[model samples]
Target: MQFRNELDFAQDLDQNDPLRVYREQFHFPKVGGKQVIYFTGNSLGLQPKISKDYVDEIMKDWRELAVEGHFYAEKPWWDYHERLAAPLAKVVGAKTSEVSVMNTLTVNLHLLMVSFYRPDNKRFKILCEEKAFPSDQYMLKSQLRHHGLDPEHALIEVRKREGEHFWRTQDVIDKILEAGDELALVLIGGVNYYNGQVFDMEAITKAGKSVGAAVGWDLAHAVGNISLSLHDWGADFAAWCSYKYMNSGPGNASGIFVHEDHLGKKDIQRFEGWWGTEKASRFMMKPEFEPISNADAWQISNPPVLALAPYLASLKLFEEVGMPALIEKRKKIVAYLEFILGEVAETVSGSFEVITPEERGCQLSVLLHGQGRPLFDYLMKNGVIVDWREPNVIRLAPAPFYCSYEDMYQFGQILKEGILKLSTVDSLG
Candidate 1:
């Protein structure tokens, strides 16, 4: 915990880390031959070396069994999707029956909205955070139009107070109360994608439910990075993509959560598909639709096993390390990064600010005064992989599973050099 300087601190932390061995399992990108400092896990996770083997197994089964792979193959393709439920449930902190792997993130969001966001004449407004992921915003708007409602009138975007970087817990509660009788559903990201704020899900859910509105979340940024208890938190539903921290390759299948309380409700509406029919009668090809009794009822088609294999591989890693331990490691790594940044900020000419520390996950948004794109491009060209948001902010995520304390320190050093070099040019001019 004590260090002479940043590099010393990083080396010391790396030497003592219990999860240090995990870094070897992932396929970190190389520049010439050396591994790049990969801080972009918030965007796309590093692939597991085992991910190829997992996919190859499925491919082999497909090639050998052809159409018969579903029932006869090892691990049986027909029930392959069900295999993911228990492990994924543990990852999201839900009961096994409450979770299921399914379509992409946006698709699952729309499907959940169909059943949960039942807007009526009086309670027709849907509440969400401002600046949610663009796909989420588009889905909400399209869903509103599908129901013959004007999005401008029906969508309520809860924004941060003036000049603020993130919303306080009370700010969200206040908006839900203000919406009151008009609020039909509250849907927000589990973590703000741009700023990395981890919203208070339990508080948000309680507030929405108090107003008799359904509550849901888009967990794309939060699921693998934080410990979530959607069942105990009383969240009505949630959805997440696996390609980021989950390490499930791009455009991989997403997962969904539905509280057990909503499962038996006969009146709840969903877009029916044959795969969602009662498992006992699914193969009967019956004309009548008897939906499955759990969250799987939301499924529209049989799962894509190839897309799921990588997730299965990653989830195994989660089970081995466990969420609680992973979160503890994340806190240490994040705090270390924060400390280094604070030190560098004091020595630098321009102001540097962290936008979402109070309510955030592994990622941090840093604002560089008067310089944004130039610094961002400089960092990327130097083999430090951070992402630039438009205008001013740069997002760096030191993920727990594969990112190291050494990685954070090195990236911090690179950032300081970038800032110092830019300052020198400014002074010369």
Candidate 2:
């Protein structure tokens, strides 16, 4: 809670960390044989050491059993997808039947939209946050066009107050009310990718419900970073990629959640496939589309077991640590990062400002007064792997699973040096 400088705080915090042992489980990247201070878990999580073994198991099954792996393999390829449900459910705070691992994030987003975003002529608008992840924005617009509606008129974006960098909960609620009659669905990021703002999901869901709209979230950033209860929160549906904080390898399989209440609604439309067909009769290759009565009904094809092994490994770590413990540990690390940044800001005469602390997750978005890319490149070259968004923002996320207090401390030092170097260069110009 208190630190004189970044290193001092890091040393103290690391000494007390309960989950510190888990760091050795990951394959931290090295530069010149030295481990880089990797704060870019928001982009790609460090791979778990167990991932190799998990992948090997699947490979072994494929080699030995050949095509018969579907029924004869150890875990049984036919039921391989079901293996992820219990652990995946634990991560998203949903019942086992309420969650399923399937498709890429964007693909699952379109599938969910098919069932939840049934826009009629009267209530045809889709509500979302401004500057949402570009993929989501593109998907919403395309969905509108697919439904024979004009996106410019049919989509509404909730934006920040003038000159601000984040949206307040009340602002979102007010916008939903303003679009009351026309709003059919509200889709928002669980955490804004650029600014790291974690929206108030429960309140947003309530507001959407009040307006007679279906509410969903894209939890790409928030899934492993924060605690979630999609089922209890009454979220109609949600989807996320596992590569970031979930530490599933790059372009890994993604997941989806559908509330149990929506399971048997035959009126709701879905783009169905044979994998979603009734499991018992699926082998019969029946013509009738009898869907499995749960979130698994949304699956369009067989699971990719190779892609899913890493997720299974990473999620087992989550189960061992538990969400509440992990979140509490994260709060300490994040608060430490924030405290050090404040110290640096004071020395720089307000040259840098943290844009979204109140709404932020572990990530902090720093806005440089006049310098941007040079400072980011300086940090990157110095072995600190923070990410730079376009124009002026650099996002630093201290993910609880793999990030260390020492790493945060080292990053603060690297950042301060980068800023000071930039200031010197600017003065010469």
Root-mean-square deviation of every model: 1.3, 1.3
TM-score, predicted candidate 1 vs. hidden true structure: 0.97
What's the TM for model 2?
Answer: 0.97
Model 2 — which ten-residue stretch has the worst lDDT? Answer: 1-10
lDDT of all predictions:
0.88, 0.88
lDDT by residue for model 1 (207-274), tens: 99999999999999998899899999999999999999999998889999999998855578988899
Clashing pairs in 2: none
Q: Report the C-alpha displacement of residue 416, candidate 1, in angstroms.
A: 1.5
Worst 10 residues of 1 by lDDT: 1-10
Candidate 1 residue runs with Cα over 4 Å from true position: 264-266
| lDDT for residue 288 in candidate 1, whole number 0-100 | 80
Q: By how many angstroms RMSD does model 2 differ from the true structure?
A: 1.3
